[model samples]
Target: MKECPQQNLIVDYVFRELDTKTKTEFEAHLKSCQSCQQQLREFKAAAPVFQKARRIHHPKRPAQNYYKTLKENFYPSMSLAQRIHEWAADFFLTPSIAMRVAQAVAMLVVGVFLGRFLFFQEPIPVAVKNETSPILAANVSDQFLRHYLQETEMILLDVANTNPAEDRQILSSVKQLAIYRQLMQKTILCREHAEELNDDVLANLINEIELILLDLCNTEDENLIETLQNVRRQIKDSHILLEINSVESRGI
Candidate 1:
C-alpha cells in the first residue's frame, strides 16, 4: 500500500499534542494503518534509549567552512548587507531557537526590502555561470550530505547503546515516548530530504535506522524485547558509522 496521508499526524498522537476531536479522529485512523502502527512500535522501543542518550553523546562536526560554504551557496552575488541580513533570518526560522515575534517581524521586513534593493539597483548583468566554480559547488553539496550523515550516526549510536532489559519499562512512560516521537519526526525530515537529493548511500543508511525506529515505536509486546536487544547489534553490524568516518577522511 502507498504510505498513509496521516503518517505525520502519528507524531502528534504519540505526544498527546492533538486536541480531543483530532485525537479521536486520529485513533480511529490509526487502527487500520499498519504503516503508522510500525512507526508507533519503533518509537516505543527507541524512547528510553533516546532518554538515556542525554548523558551520552559525542559531538562531531564537519569542516568549519561548511557554514561559509552554505552561505556562499545562498547569496553568491548579493551585496554584503543583503547576505548578512538573510543569514540572520535563517536563524529565526529554526523552531528550536526562540525568536521573539516583534524581532522576527522586523527582521523579515528589512530582509525583504534589502533583497529587493540589492538585486534591482544596477542593470542586472547576466549572472556568471558555474563553469568557474563547479568544484566549489560539489564541495558544498557534499558538506551538506556529510552534516546529515553525522546527525543520523549520532542518534543511531545513542539508540544502539540502550539496554533493552532496563529501558523497556522506561519506554512506556508518556514523557519518554513524547521525546522519542519528536526525534523520529526529525529523522523523517532528514531521511526525506536525503532521498530528494538522491544521496542513496546516506538515504539507505538512514532507512535502516528508520526501520528500527518504526519497529520499536508501537510495540509493548514484551516478546519483542529480543528484537529490541538486537537494535544495537544491527547498527554495529551495518558499520554505517565507520563508513561515514571513512568518507569524511577521504574527502568525499
Candidate 2:
C-alpha cells in the first residue's frame, strides 16, 4: 500500500507542533488513513519504552538556582558594548587551546593594523628651501619614484606573463591581491609627492599604474582573462616597462 503524505505529520501532531487548522485537517485525514494510523499507534506505544531508556541512561542532576538566589541583582544594568567587552574578557581569560589560539590571532591582527597605520602615512613633504637642499630633495624624489616604478613593473610583468588558460589557479591566488593592495597604497603616496614636486610626467604615470591596479583588483574571475589582456595591452602601448627602466636609469 502507498504511504500517505500526512504520515510525517503524525510526529508533529503527537508533539502538538501544528497549528489548529492544519491539525484539524491532519486529524480528518487520519480517520481514513489506516497506514498512518497504524504507524502513529506504534510510535505512541514505543514512546514509553524510549523515555524509560533515556531516564535510565541520563538521569537529571540537581543544581542550585543561582539566578533566583541573586534575585534582582542577577543582571546588572550595563550597556551592550560593556556587556560584550566583559563577556569577551571572561571568555579569553579561560585557559583553553581554542581560547589561546583566538587571543593570539586577535593580538596579531591588532598589531598588524597598528603597525600599518603608524608606518604607512604619506611621505612627508620635503622642506625644499627652508630645511633641505634642492639636491637632497631631488634625490629623495628620485628614490621614491624609482622604487615605485620597480615594484609596479614587477607586478605588471607578473600579470602580463600569467596565462589564464594554463595557470587557472591564479584566479584564486591570495598573494596577487595582497601585492595589488600594497602597490596601490604606495601609488597614493607617490602621487602626492609627484604633485608636490609639480612633475606631470611622474604624476601621469602614477595615475595610469593606479588605474591598472584598480582594474586588476576589481576584476571578477570570469572576466579575469579579458582584464589581464587589457592590462597587458595598456602596459605595452604606453611602453610602461620601457618608461620605468628609462626613468630609473636617469635617476627619475
Candidate 3:
C-alpha cells in the first residue's frame, strides 16, 4: 500500500489522534526527520497547559450582544476568539503583562508594610560652604582613596580573562584613572576643610569619570578601545584644570 502524505499526518500525529498502524508509521518517519523532531518538542511543551485550560468549565456562553459590546469597546482589531485565546495563554504563561502588573502591586504593598515594621526614614541633609580648613579636606581625601582602591581591586581581579592587546589599551588609560582618583581625594579634602562647601557637584563629576573607567575595564570589544582613549583625554583635561587651580591658589 502507498504511504500517507507527511503533511496529512502532522496534525493527527501532534495531537496523538492516530490509530496504532498510523502512529507506528509516523514514529518511523519522525525518527529520521530533524524538523519533525523539533516540531514535536514544541507541541509537547505547549500541549499540557492547553489541555488543562480546555478542561475548565463556565456556566454558559455569554450572550452574542455582550461579546459584541466587549469586542467593540476593548479589542476593535481582534476577534472574540483571539482575545479569549490570548487571555488564556497569558494566564498559563506567568510572565505576561497582567502578571507583571499584579507583581508590581504586591511589591508596593510589601514595601509599605516593611517601612512601617522597620521604622525606616529619609536621610538628613548636610550643609556645606567655602573657606573649609585642610584637616577636614584630609579626611575627605582619605575616604576617596579607600573608594579608589576598592574599585581598582575589582578591575584587577577580572584581568585574567582580558585579551593581551586589550590589556595594553587599558594600561594606557591607567593615567586617567589615577588622575580621577586624585581628583576624588582632593574633592573630599576640600569638603572636609570647608564644611560650608557642598561636595555634590564634584562628586557627580567624579562618578561620571569612574563609570567610564569601569566600562573600559569590563569591555572587550576592539571598537570600544578608541572610545576609551577619548574618555582618557577628557579625564586628563580635568586633571589639568585641578592642577592649574591648585597652583594659582598657591601662587606657583
* Each candidate's clash count: 15, 0, 11
Using TM-score, give the best candidate's number. 2
**Model 2: lowest-lDDT 10 consecutive positions:** 126-135
* Residues 87-139 of candidate 3: C-alpha lDDT, one tens digit per residue: 87876575778788887899999999998879966433111112232234435
Off by over 4 Å in 2: 1-142
How many residue pairs in model 2 have overlapping backbones? 0
Model 3's C-alpha root-mean-square deviation from the true structure amounts to: 18.2
The order of the candidates by TM-score, greatest first, is 2, 1, 3
Candidate 1 minimal-lDDT segment of 10 residues: 124-133
Residue 26: error of model 3 in Å? 86
lDDT (0 to 1) per candidate: 0.65, 0.76, 0.55
Off by over 4 Å in 1: 1-151, 244-252
Models, CA RMSD each: 38.5, 16.7, 18.2
Cα lDDT tens digits for candidate 2, 35-138: 99999999888877887787655333432455445654776678899999988877866657888888889999999999998888764332222234222333
Worst 10 residues of 3 by lDDT: 125-134
lDDT (Cα, 0-100) at 53 in candidate 3: 90
